[model samples]
Target chain A: MAFEIHLDNFTGPLDLLLHLIKTNEMDIYDIQMVEITEQYLTVVEQMKQLDLEIAGEFLLMAATLIHIKSRMLLPVSDEPVEEEDEDPRAELVRRLLEYQRYKQAAEALEALPQLERDVFVSRFVPTEIADSADETVSLGVFQLAEAYYRILSEVPAEVFHEVIREPLSVAQYVQLVVRQLADGQRHSFRRLVAAWPSRAELVVTFLAMLELVKMRLVEIDQVADYGDIWLKLRVAQGELAAVDLAEDGFGYG
Target chain B: MADLKRLAEAFIFAAEAPLSFERLCLLLERSRPEVRPLMQELLTEYSAGQRGFYLAEVAGGYQFRTDPDCGIWLRKLSKERPLRFSQAALETLAIIAYRQPMTRAEVEYLRGVDSGGVMKTLLEKNLLKIIGKKDVPGRPLMYGTSRQFLELFGLRSLEDLPTLKEVSALDPELAEAVPLEPESDN
Candidate 1:
C-alpha cells in the first residue's frame, strides 16, 4: 500500500514506523519484515530528498530494520526455536509498545483543561504576599549565563606575559551595581557590562549581579527569550547606603 | 442557600490563586463536607446561569475564570501571551509524567531521537525536575513532573489523568497502534 510519509508529521523514525504499521493494519506481533523494511527505506529516501536533517538515530534504526529483515529471510531450523531466541522483532516491538503508551498518555494530557487555555487561575495576589515579595522581577540564571557569554565574546582574547591579580570581589560589584541603580530605574544587563573596560572587570561585574540577586537587593527581568535583560534595585533609597556598607564590610572581612 | 453560593463566588473571585477546598473551609469556618457541596452548587449555578465567568476546579482548588467562549475577549483585554508547547515537549512530558523516575536514555529510547535539548527546556521552564539518580550502572538522573507542571496543566493530581484507553479512543488510528492493555512495566 502507498503511504505518503511526511517527516514533520512524525516525531521521529519510530513514530513513522508505527504509523506505517498502523496504516497497513498489520499485526504488530506478526510484522511483514520485507514489506516494512522497503517502506522504511522509502521514507528515509524521501527525508533525504527533502533535505531534512535525518538524525543518526533514524539511520541506525534503518540499519536495524534491514538486519531484522535479513535475519527473517534465513531458513528456519527444523527443531523448535528456544524461548531466548525470540522473534527478531521482539526488541523493536517492546520499544514501540512503550512509546505508544506514552503517546496515549500525552494525548490524555492534551485533552485536559490547561492553564491559560481552558482555565486560568487568578493572577491576583493577596496584598500582604505581594508586599513582602516586593513584586521583584527576575530572569533565570541561564539567561545571565548567556549575557555573560555575549560580553566575554566581545572582549579580545588575552595573551598574558605575567600573572596580574586584581583585587575584585563580588561584594564590590554588588555595591557598584547598587550605586548605578541608585535612581531606582531599570538598567539593561548589556549597559552594565559596557561600563567595565576589561574582561576581568566584566567577569567581576557579572558575578556581582549574581550576588545581588542572591541577596534580594536587585531584581532582573527578561521579557522574552534572548531578549534584553533589565535590572532594578529592590531596596528603598534610605536602605541603599546601609546595604552597601553592610555588603562592603562583609566582602572585606 | 443563595447567600452561601454568593459567598463562595466572592471568595474564589478575590483569591490570587486557586483556593483549595481546605482553605475555603478554613476561611468559611466550615467542614470539608460542607464546603465541597457549596462549591459544586456554585459551579452548577454558574453553568446554568450562563454567566461570563465560571467556577473551575484546577490544581486541587476552585477558582473563578472567564468562560472558554469568552476567551478571545479576555485575551484582547489582558494582552497576555499564551503558553505554547511543542509536540516533542508534550510527548516527552507525557512519558515523564507517567513513567517517571525514568532516565534520559530511557526517554530517548522511547522517543527515537536525542531529547537533550527538549529536556533542558522543560527543566528550565520548571515543568520537569530531577527527582534523583536511579540506581543503575551509570546512575543516570531520574526525572519526574514538577508541581509547576500540575498547576500549568490544570491537573488536580496525577490521579486526574485519563487512562490510556480513554485517550486512544479519541483517534481510531491511535487506538489501533496502542493496545488496549499495555504490557510494559511502565
Candidate 2:
C-alpha cells in the first residue's frame, strides 16, 4: 500500500529511508540499492511536487544511493579482492543500523513510566521554615560603592549645576527608598539610585541608603558574589515610622 | 523510640525534590549503617505493589510516585498538559543521552539531520545541560543529560539505563569503523 509521506512526518532522510525500507520489507543487511534508490527518488520527487522543504541531507543520501547503484552496475574484474576493500553500501548500512538502534532506544525511553507524564510524585511541599538559610550575603560598603560608581559612570556628567535652593536631605532620600521598596520587591540598588537626575542627588541617596541600613530600616543584600546589590525593607512600611530615625540622629532638614 | 522507616517515609512524602540518602541521614540524625536498612525496608514495603504509590529510587534519590496507570485520572484532576515528544526530539534525546558530551554536529551526523533546534528544545526542557566545552580548537560546548532526565525517565542514574544490545553477526571490521568518539572529519 503506497502512502504519501510529509516532510514533518519524518525526522530526517535516514529516518525516511528506514521507513521506506521497513514498508517494503527490504532486508536491511542487503539493501537492494537499485530498487531502493528508485523508490527514494520517487518520494523526493513527490515531496518536491507537494512543495515540502526537503532537507539537503535527503538530497545528499539520494546522491549517495545513485553513486552506489552506478558502482554496482560496473563490470567486476576477475582480479583477487583486497582485504581492505569495502562495499559502497557498507557505510550506509552501518549508519542505518546504528540509527535503527537509537530509534529503538528512543521507543524504549518513550515506553518507560515517565515522571509528570505516565506517573506522578507527591506534590506535597512543607511550609517553609523561617529561611535562616537565605544565601544572600550582607552588602559590604566597598561593594556598594563599586555598584554606585558603576551606575554613576552610566549617567552623563551634569551640563549645568542648578542653584542649591533646597539641599537633598538624607532623611527624605531614606523615606524615598522606603517607599520604593514598600511593594516588598527587591529593587536593584543601582536602578533605584540611578533615577536621580544629578550626581549630587545620587550621592545623597547613596548616603541615605547607608543611613537606612545603619538604622535597621532597610537591608542591603548581595544574592551572589559580585552580583547586583538589592535594597529591601527590613521592617514593614508602618514600622519604618516607629524605627527611631530621629534617635539615629539623621534629622529631617 | 523513633520508627526510622516512618520518619523516612514522612520526609520523602513531604519533599518536593527527591530525598537523597545523604539528606535522609542528616534529617534523621542517624549513621549510614543504621539508616540504610530502614530505607531498604521502606523501599521493600513499597515495592510489594500493594500501595497506591511506590517509593521510586530515581535521580539518585527516593520519591513517592503513584502508579503509571493512575496517570490518566491524575491528569484529569490536575489538568497538566502531558509533555509530548516528537519523533525528532525523541531521537535527538536518545542520541544525546547515550552518546552525550557530544556536540550538535555529532548528533546531526548520527541522525543525518540538523539538530540544533531539537537540542535547543531539549536544553530548554532541562533534560540536557552543557557540561563544558570540548577541548578541540573550536571548543564547541558539550552536552550531557541532566539529573532531571533520569528523574523523568524513572532511571536511578545513567548506570540504570538498559545496556545497548550488541548488533548481531556484524562484520568485525565494519563494527570497528563505527566511531564512538568525535573524529576530525576531513
Candidate achieving the largest DockQ:
2
Report the error of model 1 at residue B48, Å. Answer: 7.7
| Candidate 2 lDDT over residue span A1-253, tens digit each | 2445555767788877777676666777788988899889988897899887878888999999999999888877678778846777888888888887787778778888888787887774544632443434434333455579999999999899677655767777877877798898888988997789688888888888889888787789897998878888888778777765442478554
Clashing pairs in 1: A124-B16
Model 1 clashes, total count: 1
Across A27-137, the per-residue lDDT of candidate 1 in tens digits comes to 888889999889898878868888988888889999999999998888889898877577889898877877777777777687665667655546767677766753333
The segments of candidate 2 whose C-alpha lies over 4 angstroms from its true place after superposition are A1-3, A80-84, A126-253, B168-186
Candidates in order have lDDT scores of 0.76, 0.79
Q: How well is each residue in B95-177 modelled by candidate 1, as lDDT tens digits?
A: 88877888899899889988999999998787887777889898888888876788777667777667655322123458464
Cα-based TM-score, every candidate: 0.62, 0.66
Model 2 clashing residue pairs (backbone): none
